[model samples]
Target: MGFNPRDAIESVKDIATNAVERSADIVDSAGHILKGDVSGGVEGIVSSSMDIATHSVYKIKEIATGRGDDLDEIV
Candidate 1:
């Protein structure tokens, strides 16, 4: 049997998507377990974690695009 490019692409895509979904579920579960770590509080921990993740992603994009400090100073 001959190898088909379309079928190969589809198989790879399915594997990648499944892996991503499983990893996300694990993170979600961990977050839920820690949501009340601060005497049943949920603000400081979750909010700060989300902010850091978002900022890191934004910084990565800016640096990757060659914007560096210029984009930060402008924004």
Candidate 2:
């Protein structure tokens, strides 16, 4: 059996093509994961901020209407 240089070159090309394709896939997957994590974090922060603002507004309204007074008046 004789070693053919052409066959060896073709085999090397195939290996290189597969490696490049796999690397691209890995990078794409990582990008998707990062985007999901960042999106979730931003959503959480916005939700928490809205909840705090709602509570603060409720408390302000109560105080303004004298409903939060703790002192008793002598009539």
| Candidate 1: worst-modelled 10 consecutive residues by lDDT | 36-45
Which residue runs of candidate 1 sit more than 4 Å off their true CA positions? 32-75
Cα RMSD of predicted structure 2: 31.5
Among these predictions, the greatest TM-score belongs to 2
Estimated TM-score per prediction? 0.37, 0.40
Candidate 1 local lDDT, residue 22: 53
Instruction: Give one digit per residue, the lDDT tens place, for model 1 in 1-75.
Output: 344556555545655555565556556656766765543234444554565555555554454444435545656
Clashes of 1: 0
In candidate 2, what are the lDDT values of residues 1-75, reduced to their tens digit?
234555555545655565565556555555655778666555555554555554444444443443433323311
lDDT of 2 at 28: 59
Residue 53's lDDT within candidate 2 is: 53
